[model samples]
Target chain A: MIDWFQKLGRSSLALFERLGRGGLFLMRVFAAIPSLVPRPRLVIIQLYSVGVLSMMLIVISGLNVGMVLGLQGYNTLVDFGAEESLGQVVALSLVRELGPVVAALLFAGRAGSALTAEIGLMKATEQLSGMEMMAVDPMKRVIVPRFIAAIISMPLLAAMFSAMGILGGYFVGVGLLGVDSGAFWSQMQGKVDFYEDIMNGLVKSVVFGFVAAWIAVFEGYDAVPTTEGVSRATTRTVVHTAFAVLGLDFILTALMFGSV
Target chain B: MIQKRTQEIAVGVFVAVGLAALVMLAMKVSNLSSLSDQDGFEVIARFENIGGLKERAPVTVAGVRIGRVKTVIYDDKSYDALVTLSIAAKHNQLPEDTSASILTAGLLGEQYIALEPGGAETMLKSGGEIKLTQSAFILEQMVGQFLFNKAAEGTGESKAAEGAGP
Candidate 1:
């Protein structure tokens, strides 16, 4: 029993330590934001790698998600003789819920893990230390650009995902299932709102981007400078990012949609 | 150097498309594009019940949208639901006798206002109130009313038979 108590104490202490470190890391990143404006080249490179490179994965998953929605939504809507509202169902679900959440999850898995691994490797290789020795702040030169790029890219990725998903739904619903193309488009047009559905989704994506990216960068920076430590940090980045994005999505959705 | 330039261009394109999609979503999803940029005239309508109708719901005339619902209010003294509509300026020729009805898009879709034009020469200007209006038809209320009437009739018949017993 005494051993158990000691273990509990140790874990709590470690948790507190990590929390303090993370809070400081986040502040440092925020403080580095102004430096990005003067030298956008650093930020743009990360954007290309993180944002543009992930496009292929996002597009593929978006298409598949749409096709699945079309197949499932069509069958269910047919039961209620609401086959014409297939577009509305697909569009609303994608734009309001699935698009942002799934995109963030994908972003976390892809870009978030990569960010952690890359930074972790840099630390392990003494490159971050080398920058310090050269009197360059690694926070400004390394972490800030990636963080800003991530926030910029997330909503764009989400929009593209939703747009592609809608097209996939159309292909399946109209091309294969023979749902009325006109009604599909018209119903979607009539029901979906700009402020409520699209704007809220964009906001959710941005929030998720900030969170997921922060986790990735922080995990990398905080990891012990070793091979095993870097690998562990990468895995933790993805896991933690996924959880944060989903939990935050729930809270934001309620605030945006729940009669407020 | 060329690779970097290409990457920059690609990012720019991606951002541009994303912004366009956002605009499309805003306009199409909210159905804001249905209303033109032209200024519209605000008019008032009162109903005994607005049902599930919401503000920003489209106000259409003869199956064509002419405006949107600007506000919904409940009159304290009169105990009636008041709806404010903003009709398009170009379509400002709605007669004073024109009637307004709250309708659904489809059987189980969103509620909207449908205006039926009347054969009056005078046009309704801003702040004009549509006198003849129909409230939303709720299926639940109709079913409740029907069941209640049937039960009442059955009880009444039983009472009459007992009173007339020989």
Candidate 2:
């Protein structure tokens, strides 16, 4: 009984300690931002690696997801003699929920895991320490640029995802199925409001990006400097980011789309 | 140096394409392009009941949308629904005595305000009140009235049958 109680206490304490460390690490990254502004190249390069590289994954997944939505929606809507509303259903589902959530989840697995692994490997090889020895702030040079790149790229990727998804939906809805092209486009335009639906979706993606990037970098920086440790940190980054993105999505949806 | 330049170009293209997608979403998918860039005047109409008539619903004339429902408010004193409409400036020549009625799009779709022109010398200006207005047809009320009529008819037929037998 005593051993079990002690174990529980130890685990709780460890959890709190890790949370505090992560919070402080995030603060350091924020603090490094002003210094980072002078050098845009670092951010640009990171953007190329993180944002540009992930484009294919986001776009492809978005298309497939949208096509699936179109197929499923058509089948169900046809039963109720509401196949005309397929466009509305597809656009609403993609813009309001799936677009941001799926993009962020993919971003976490793709760019996020890579970020953790890269940073962990750098630590294992003592590159961070080498920079520190040269009187360079690793946070400013290394972490901040990557973090900013993530923030910049996320909304753009999500926007692209939604756009591609809409196209995919259109192709499936109009081209494959016999739904009227005019009706599909007109219905989507009439129903989906720019502010209520699109802007709110952008907001959700931005938040997800922030959280995902934060977790990725923090896990990497905090990893134990060993080969096995680096692998573990990468896994942790992906798992933690996935959970955070999904949980935050629900909260954001409630706050943004909840009122009406 | 060449490698660096190509990479930078790729990044630029990526950003541009992404922004283009956002624009397409705004212009093509959503109502931003259609609704924005127009300064319109507001007009008011009162209805007995507005039945699912929401704000931002289309205000149409002869099946053509000219404006949108700006606000829907309940009048405390008259117990009527006062709806404000924002009509585009280009459509400024609508007659003052135009009739406004609530209409549904499809069988069970969105409700919009339909306006019919009247032969009047005067034209509707900002804040002008449309005098002739029709309320939305409530489905439940219609069904209830229908059932009541059927019951009344049945009772009358039974009474006639009893009288004939006696």
Candidate 3:
């Protein structure tokens, strides 16, 4: 039993090592040919997919999160006769952790999976092979554009999420709960720091984008022509990328903030 | 080909608008910060203990944040907490004999400094220290006291029943 457990652990470690190496290799390949691709066009496509398309989800989710936080936080603060601090609590929680992480996860599920499947289908159809045979590097042509797009998109989406969430908290806490709006905004302004919490969230989004794109591309490139293979790869890409993003978020948060 | 081109164009426009929205939001937040900075005052309070009183904790009057906690320092000589607060300049004139208390937001929430104004003719100036202060009410102690009181009540009730019995 012990030997079986040890073997399981070893296999898991080996799997992670392979993934890390593969991700690193893809990053390097894309990094080496920066100027070879059309930067502006790729960035525009990324902006559309990551930012504009993501706005509705970001807003809805952010508002609900903010409202729930305010409702819970206000109740607790009222007990100690410090209900006015609800604004600070809501804002800090939104900017520091919840907003960025949730936004990234949503983005990964919505767009990241699609990106992987699209690339996977292209691979299965021999299009990528044809591009490579014709001396058009797949990394520069397909992967680079998606990579650049995701990096740009995730941060912008996170910022939108944070802002919308704060507004939602404001409406629920001040308007619905009867807490003073002035007090709420003032407390939030006084307590929250853009450089520390908000900036950290943006940086995390950038990293998430990279992970999502890499997973999609890797799965797509390795996909078999069979329908089942494409379906499995797509599912794996989304599930694994989401978990990886969450795990990476915790490590980055700890490193950036130093024990919360 | 037309559909693809149009989709790409639509996406491009969407990205522009999203970026613009973020920039505007940032500008608005910054503006709000500056406005608050221009109009605020300061006061000082002392406490026995400030459990989780952060630097930017709100100072509320009737559940309104008229001020914020500026700093917290330990005074070894008096064994007290010296908390400085920044109030909105308009609300600067506070009664001389005000009471300051350390309060928790919830069961496990953050703590803050609460100011209760006293009925006095004279107003306090900047750097003035509030003398009458209350420390945070520890939850464990409160729960312990309640349980003990309940047990005592039960014992007294049983003794009275024994005395009344044949």
Q: Which candidate is the best by DockQ?
A: 2
lDDT of 1 by residue, A78-184 (tens): 99999998999999999999999999999999999999999999999999999999999999999999999888889988988898888889999999999998989
User: Which segments of candidate 3 are over 4 A away from where they belong?
Assistant: A1-17, A36-39, B1-13, B20-32, B35-166
Error of 2 at A77 (Å): 0.9
The TM-scores, one per candidate, come to 0.93, 0.97, 0.66
| Candidate 1 local Cα displacement, residue A216, angstroms | 0.8
Q: Assess the local accuracy of residue A219 in candidate 1 as a C-alpha lDDT between 0 and 100.
A: 97
TM-score of structure candidate 3: 0.66
Compare the candidates by lDDT and give the number of the best one: 2
**Which of candidates 1 and 2 reaches a greater lDDT?**
2
Deviation from native of the Cα of residue A232 in model 3, angstroms:
1.5
TM-score of model 2 vs. true structure: 0.97
Better of 1 and 2 by TM-score: 2
Tens digits of per-residue lDDT for model 2 on B1-166? 9989988998998899889989998888999877962589989999999999999999999999999999999999999999999998889899999999999988788999999999999999889999999999888888999999999999999999999987
Q: What is candidate 3's lDDT per residue for A1-260, written digit by digit as tens? A: 99999999999998998778776768665674565455667556555665667778877888899889989999999998778888889877877788778888888778787777888888888889899999988877777677677777777777777777777888889989999888787666665666666667667877887787678767766677667788888898888887988899889988989854
Poorest 10 consecutive residues by lDDT, candidate 3 chain A: A32-41
Q: How does chain B score by TM in each prediction?
A: 0.80, 0.93, 0.73
Candidate models: Cα lDDT each = 0.89, 0.93, 0.76
Which segments of model 1 are wrong by more than 4 Å?
B28-30, B35-38, B148-166
